[model samples]
Target chain A: MKHCLILGAHSDVALAIAHQLAKEGHSLWLAARRFQDLEPIQKDLEIRYGVPVACFAFDAEKPESHQAFVEALPECPDEVYLVFGYLGPHPGSLEHPTDARRIVQVNFAGAVSVLQALALAMQKRGKGAIAGISSVAGERGRKSNFLYGSAKAGLSAYLDGLRNYGYHHGFHVCTVKPGFIRTAMTAGMDLPKPLTASPEQVAKATISGLRKKKGRVYVLPIWRWIMCLIRNIPDSMFRKKQL
Target chain B: MSPFKQSISNWGNYPLTESLVYQGKERPASGPYIARGMGRCYGDSASQAQIWSSRANRCMLDFDSNTGVLTAEAGLTLDEILQTFVPRAWFLPVTPGTKFVSLGGAFASDIHGKNHHGNGCFSDHVLWIDLENAEGEVLRCSREKNQELFELTAGGMGLTGIILRVALQLHPIETAYIKQRSIRCRNLQETLEQILAHQHWTHSVAWIDCLAPGKAMGRSILLLGEHAKANELPEKYQNQALKPHSTQQKNFPFFLPGFALNSFSVKTFNFLYYHKHLPKQKEQLVHYEPFFYPLDAIGHWNRIYGKRGFTQYQFVLPPDQVDGLIKIIETIRAHGMGSFLTVLKLFGPQKENYLRFPKEGFTLAMDFPLSPKLEGFLSQLDALVLKHGGRVYLTKDLRMPPEMLMASYPQAEQFRQKIKEMDSKATFQSLQSQRLDLHL
Candidate 1:
C-alpha cells in the first residue's frame, strides 16, 4: 500500500484526502498547525481503513519547523497533498502590508519551501506525486480578490516549474485550479448556488485528477468555456466598467 | 482597486455549466462591476472586477421605446431586452446567433448578426457607455469622451473597466418573423453568385453539408430573408402576429451514447437535412428564434457531441481564397468523423479593432468531437488556412495551437500591446490565455 501525507490535515480538503487515501489502503501521516485539529480525522482514518494514521503539528510559515515536520514523520509518505492556504480579506489586506505578506507567505513562499524540500526527498526516492491547491481566481487578477490571487499565481507558476523539473525523474506535480467551492472559508459569502462546488465535490475531483496525474484540472469543467468567452473581451469595451 | 479574477481549468474545452456567476445582488465599491451580458466577449473589455463582485448595487438607468433607445443596467440581458422591446415592435439593432447573451456581453464581444452585411458589429449601433475605472471614477465615453476607450471597448473585452450602463439603438420591426426564401445552390459557384445577385436582401445565410464530397461537395441551401409585416402573416395568425412566443422549450437530458452520432448516422441525417429543403424553395414567415437558433430549440444541445464534448472549428478565408473552401471540405470529408452542424457566412468589411476576427471573407463554423485524430486534422487545417492567408475565429476555438493563434492573428502583438497598457498590472486573464500562453 502507498503512504500518503496530508500536509494541512486539519483543513477540510486535506482531511478528506486523508480519508480517501486510507480507504484506498494508503498509510497516512496527517499534519496540521495544531495536532488536535487532526485528531478526529486521524481516528476515522485509522478505524475505517485499518491502517496506521498519525497526526503531527505543522506551522507552514516557520521554515525551521517544516524540515523537522517532514523528518519527524514516523513513516516516509510516498505522496504529499498540500492543502494549506489563507484568504486575506481585501480591504483589510490592502491596508495592512503585514496581513498581505502573511497571506502570501502561507500561500506561496511557505508552500514552495515545504513542497520543494519534500520534492527533493521524493526525487531521491525516484517516484512520488505532489499535488497543490491553486485557485481559478489566479487566472486573472481581480480588484476584488487579488491578494489571494497574486499568491496563487506565484504558487501555480512554482508548481509548473517543479512539474517540469521532476517529470522524467518520475515525480508528478498536479496543480488544482478550483473555481468556487462552498466551504467554511466561503460561508456567508453570497456565491451563486449554480457556480459554487461543494467541498466534497472538490475532494472527489481532486482525487480523480490525482489518479489521472492531470497537470491541471478545473474542479468544475465549465470554467473552460466561461474563460474562453471572458478572454476575448476587448479592452476598449473592457475598460468601460467593472464586471 | 485590483480587478476581480475569473478563470477556467485546462481539462476541457467549454466552460462548465456552473462557471457562469450571474451577479445576483452584487455591486462594486465604485458601483457594481459591469454585468457581462452574454460572456461572449474575448477579453477584459467589459469586466469591472471590484465593483461587480459586491452585493447591494443594482439599477436600470433608462430606456426609451419610441426611438428603440435602451439605456439599462450593465447587467441586463439580450433576453430581457428582447422580452421588453419585441412587444413594442423593437428588436436588437444587431443580434448574434443566440439571444441568451447579455447586453454587456454583446457589447464586450462586439457581436454581429446575419444582418452584419447591412449593419456592422454591435459597435456600429452603440452610442455611448458609462465606465467605472480602477479609481472608482465613472466616465462617459462615446465616439467622444474617452474616444480611445470607446473604440477599444466597442470590440474590447472588458479590460479598460466595468460597464455600468449602455445606451444602444434598437431596430424597429413590424413582426418577429422573417419572410424567408430557401434556394438550393448546385455548388460553391452558385452559392457565391446567388449572394452577389441577392445583395439587397437584408439577411442571408447558407447551410453547407461539408461531409458531402466531390460533385455534391459545395452544394448548399441558401436562405434569403426580409423582415416580415403583420399583414403578411397567414390570416389565421395575423391578429397575434406581433405577439411574443410562449412556446415550450425542449431539452436534451444527457449525453447520448457515442456510437449514436457516428458517420453512418450523420451521413444519413445530412442527406435527409439536405433534401428536406428541396425543389429550390419555400417562402414562409418563420419565427426569429428558429431562424437564428435552430439548435436552440433543444436545450443542452452540446450533449449531442456525447460526454467527450465537442469543439467548434471555425475559420475564415479571404474572398480570393474561395479555393480553400474546396480544401476545407476535402479535409473534413477525409477526417471521416461525423459533424452535425456546419454553417457558412459571408463577412463584410473589417471593423476598426486591430484584432477583429471577421473580415471580407467566407467564414465556416462546424462542430466535431475531440477524437484522438482531431488534433492532427486541425493542425493540417490550420496549415491550409495559414497558407491561404486566413485565420481561425478565437471565440469558437478550443484546441488551436499557440503558434497557429499567433500566426493567424498577426495583429496579436498590437492587441497585446494595447491591453498591456490598459491593464499594466496584468489583471485580466482566462484559461484560453493560459492554454494558448497568450498572456505573458
Candidate 2:
C-alpha cells in the first residue's frame, strides 16, 4: 500500500484522484483551504474505499507554511499530487495586479514552493512520484487566458526540470496536461463535448501515467497532437488570430 | 463552480433547453436547487431550470453487515454499487433496467425492476432518506420521521427536495448468477397469462415486439429468474460462489441517421427478435446482468435512435381494464409507427404513500421518436391511459397533457399541497413541476 499527500485537495480533480488512489488502498493526507469542508471527502474515502485519510487546512498562497505542512504531516507519503489551479472571472481579471498575481501564484509560484520542500525530502528518501496538473492551455499563449496559461506553462517547465532530477534521484516526476475538464471551474464554459472530460476520467489517466512512469502525458492524448499543431503555426499567423 | 448558462437534455435528446447549470462534486453553497443524477431520466424530471448535478456528490456512507444495509450518497450509480457489493454476496433489492442510474435517481423515481411483483419499488428497500429542502436545511425522512416529506420525495420527480443520501437494504444472495427461463408468447393475452403464471418467480418481465400486427400483436418473450446458489451451478463452477464477470461494453458511437430506425426496419428487427426464441419455453443459467438489463450491454444504446432522440411513454392499467390495454396496442398499430423497445411487466398492489407509478395490474412501456406528429399521438395515448384509470410514469413521460396528468394520478393534488408547504417560498422547482403545474 502507498501513502499519498494531496495538495489543494478540495478541488474536484484532487478529490477524484484521491478517490482513485483510495480505491487502491492508499493512506492519504488531504490538505485544502478549509478542514471542515474536507471532512466529508475524508470520511467518504475512508468509508467507501476503506482507506486511512486525514485532512488539514492549507493555503497555497502562504508560502512560509509549505515546509511546515509537509514536515508536520502524521505520515510521510510515497507520492505527492499537486492539483491546485485558479482561473478567476473571465472578463478583465488581469486588470487587477493583485488578482492577476494571485492567479499566477496559486497556480504556479505557490505550487512550486510547496513541491520544492517535499521534493528535497523525497530526494533523500530516494523513492516517490511527484505529479502536477498542468493544462493543455499552457502549450501556447491565447488571448482569453494568457495569465493562467503562462502560470501553467511555468509549472510544466518546472515539472520538466523535476523529471530530469527525479530520474537521477530514483523518484518519478510526472507532468499532466489535461484538456477541457468538466469540473466545477469549467461548468458553464460551453466547451466542445469531444474535448471535455470528467474529473474521474482525468484522474484515472493521471494516476495511470504516474504508475507507468510516463513523465509527461495528456489526459485524452489527442491534446498532444492538437498542441503540436498549434505550436507549429507561424508566429505571424498565430498573432493575427484570437483563440 | 458558479452557475453558468448551458444547454442540457435528458436521456431523450429532444426538447433540449438552455438553463442555469451548476455541475460540481459538492452541493453549491446557496439557493433552491434541483438535484440531477446522471441525467438518465427519459424526460425532463432530472433537468430544467437551475440544475445542480449529483455527479460529484457520490460517497458511500455506511454498510451494516448484519442488517444487509448499504448507505450511499445520492449520486452513487447502481453499477458502482453492484460492482462493489455483488462480490460480497449481496445485491440491490430492486434495480431499474439500466445500471447507470444513480441511487437518488432510483429513489426519487421509485424505480421498479422485473421483481416488482415479488418485491416492490426501490423505496421499499430504503431505510431512510436525507433530503435537503429549499431552505437548504437537511431533514431526515423515513417511515418514522418526517414521513410526509419522505412520501412526497419518493417518486415526487425531484420536486420536493434534493435527496442527499439514501440508506438501502440489500438482499443477500448465494452467488452472482441468475437462473433464467424464457417463454415465448404469441400475443398480448398469452403474454399476460405467462407473466401471471410466473408470479411466484423472484423476477419476471416480458419483451414485446410492438411492430407485430393483427393476431400477432404484442408477441413477446417472457423471462423469469431466481438467484442461482453455488450448489445450483454446474459442478465445475460450484466452488466459486462470487466471481467477478466481465462488464465489457461496446459503445454505439455516433447517432445513426434519422432514417435508420423507421417502421420497415423496426418491423424487420422486431420480427427477427420474436422468432429468434422459437421454443415455447427454454431454461438457461446466465449472469444476472444480461438477464436484467440487456440494453446495458450496448453503451449509449439510446444514441441508436438518432439525433432527434426518442420519448418513452410508460403507463400501468388496472388488470380488469384489459379492453383499455388492447385499445392502446391497437392505437399504436393504427399509427403504423413502431416502438422498437416495448416492455411489459406486472406490478403488485400500490404501497401506501409512495406516489408509485405501478398498481396491482400490468404496465406497458414503449419508446417513440419525437416528431411533429408525435405530440398528437402521445396525447391520444395519454387520453387512453387516463380513461383506463392508469397514470403515466412521470420519470419516463416527456409529453403527457396537463389535464391527463391530473386525471391519472389523483394523489398528485395532495402531493402538490405537501410540496407547497415544504417549499413554502416555492424555491425548489423543476421542468416536470412546471409542466404539470404541481405548485397548485
Candidate 3:
C-alpha cells in the first residue's frame, strides 16, 4: 500500500479519491483549509477500509506557508494529489481585484509553491508521483468563466513543465483535465446531463491514470475531443456567440 | 447559497409538487420547513414547499466496534452504512425493504422489516438522537432523557423537528450471506401458516400473487432467512465470508409505456414467479442484498410502472382480522387492478409511540399503478381497512383522507398538540402533514 497525500481533502472530488485509495488499502494524509471538516471523513475511511489516515490544517491561498506544510508531514508521501481550486463569481471576480487574486492564488500559484517543495523532497528520495487536477475550461477562454479558466490554463502549462522535470528525475507527474463535474462546486448550475461526470467517476479515472503513469488524463475520454473542438473554434467567430 | 425552485417527488414519483430546494451545509433559518433525505419515502412525507435536504449532512460522528454502537448524521443512508460496516462484521439491527432510505427518514417512518417479528422497528435500536427543534435549538433525547419528546419524535414524521444526528445499535453478523428457505404456499391460509411456523427464523416475508383467483387466491412464496455461519457457506464463499456484496445495478433508464403493466402481464409474471420454485420447499445460501432488498437490484425500478407513477398501499390489521385480509385481497382481484408487487409479513407487539405503523398483526403492502379509477378503488379499500380496525402506513400513502388518519391513529391528535407545544408556530410542515391536517 502506498502513502498518498491529498491536498484539498474537503472537496467532494477529494473525498471520493480518498475513499477509492483507502479501499485499495492505501494510507492517507489528508490536508485542507478547514481540517475540522476532515475529522468525520478520516474516521470513516479508517474504520471502513482498515487504513491509517491523518488530517492537517492547510491553506491553499497562503503560498508562503506551503513549503513549511510539506516539511511538517509525518513522512514524505509516495504520491501527492493537488485537488484544491476556486471558481469565483464571473462578473464579480472580473470587477474585483481581491476575488480575481484569490482565484489565481489558490488554483495556480499555491499549487506551484507546494509542488516545488514536494518535488525537491521527492527528488532527494529518488522516486515519487504527482497528479494535479486541471480543468477543461483551460483549453479555450470563454466569456462565461475566463478568469477561472485562465488560472487553470496556467496550472496545466505548469504541470506540463513539471512532467518534463519528473522525466529527467525518477518520478512521474500527471495532469488531469475534467469537464463538468457534479460536485458541491457545481451544485445548482444547469450543466449538460450527459457530459457531467460524478465525483466518483472522476476519482476512478484519476486512479487509473496514476496507475498507468500517463502524462495527461481526461476524466471523461470524450472531454478530450470536446476540448479539442472548442480549441479549434476561430476567435473571430467565437467572440460573437454566447458560450 | 440561495434556494432553487424545482419540482420534487418521492420514490413513488406521484403527486409532484413545486418546492424551494436547499442543500446548504448549515441549517437554514426559516419557518415551516421539512427535512428531506434521498426522497425514498414513496410518497409526500418528504416533499414540501420549502425542502431542507439533509443530503449534505452525511457523516459518521462516532463508532464503537466493541459495542457495535454507531453515531452518525441523520442524512446517512443505510446503503452507505452497510458498505462501511458489513465488511467489518457489523450490520443494521433492522432495515426496511430498500437500503436507500436515510437514517432520519427511517426514524421518522419507524420502518420495520422482515425481522419485525423479532427485532421490532428502527427506533427500538436507536439509543439517542440529537434533534434540532423548531426554535433552532438542538436537544439530546433518549428513553432516559427527554422521554416525552423521544416518544413524540419516534414516528412523529418531520413535524416534531429536524433530526440532526442519531446514535444507533448495530447487530453483529458472522457472514454477509443468509441461509434462505423458500416455501411455496397454495393460498393465503397456507402462506400465513408457514409464516407462523417459521417464527424462529430471523427474517421472514412472503411474496403474494395478488391477481390469483378463488381457490388459488393469495398463492405465495414464503421466504425464511437466518444469517449464515461461515461454516454454512460453500468452499467458494467461505474465504470471503464477511465480504460485503458488490452489486452491479442495472438502471431501468426510462419510463415504460403506460400500458406495460396491465392485469394480464402482471398475472403471467406472478404465475412464472410462483412456479419458478418448482418444488414445495427449497433452500440455498444467498447474499443479504437480495434477501433484504430485491427490487434495489434494478435501479429506478419504479419507472417500470410508467410516467404516471404508482402508490404502495400498506396496512396492518389486528391478529383476529384474517377474514378482513381475505376480503381485501378478493376485492383487489375483483377490481382487476393487478398489484404487481404484494408483500405480507407478521409483526410483533408494537411499542407506544406517537405515530408508528407496526403492531401485533399481519401487514400487507401492494403497489398499484396510478389511474383515474385508482383513487376511487383505494378509497373503497380504505373504508374496508378502517372497518376491520386497520391503519394504512403513512409513509407509503400519497392520498389518504384526513379523517382516515385520525380514525386509524388514535394518538394522532395528541401528536399534533405536542407539535404545537414544541414549535408554537408550526414551523415544520410536509405535504403529508398538511393533507392529514397535522399542522396546528
DockQ of each: 0.01, 0.51, 0.49
Candidate 2 pairs with clashing backbones = B25-B56
Candidate 3 Cα lDDT to native? 0.89
Better of 2 and 3 by TM-score: 3
Give the least accurate 10-residue stretch of model 1 chain A, judged by summed lDDT: A40-49
Ranked by DockQ from best down, the candidates are 2, 3, 1
Native-vs-model 2 lDDT? 0.84
Model 1 lDDT per residue over B1-440, tens place: 12333542111224432232234333343332344444443223223323243111123344565677777656666765666567778888888776666666566667777777777788788889887655657888899678877766665555556677688898999998889988898777888788777768888888877777778876788888888987788877677666665445688898887678888888888788888986877887888777876765776666777776567777888888988877888878887754766778787887547555677788887777767777888889899999998898665667677788778877666667776776665444444544566455
Question: What CAPRI class is candidate 2?
Answer: medium
Candidate 3 i-RMS? 2.6
Worst 10 residues of 3 chain B by lDDT: B23-32
2 or 3, which is superior by DockQ? Answer: 2
Off by over 4 Å in 3: A91-93
Give one digit per residue, the lDDT tens place, for model 3 in A136-241.
Answer: 9888888888888889999999998998998889788999987889976576568898789999998988888987999899988888888888899999999887
lDDT string, candidate 3, B246-363, tens digits: 6578899999998888999999999999988899999999999989988888999999889999999999998899999999999999999767779999998886577889988999
Which structure among the candidates has the greatest lDDT?
3
Mark the regions of model 1 whose C-alpha exceeds 4 Å error after superposition.
A1-243, B1-60, B437-440
Ranking of predictions according to lDDT? 3, 2, 1
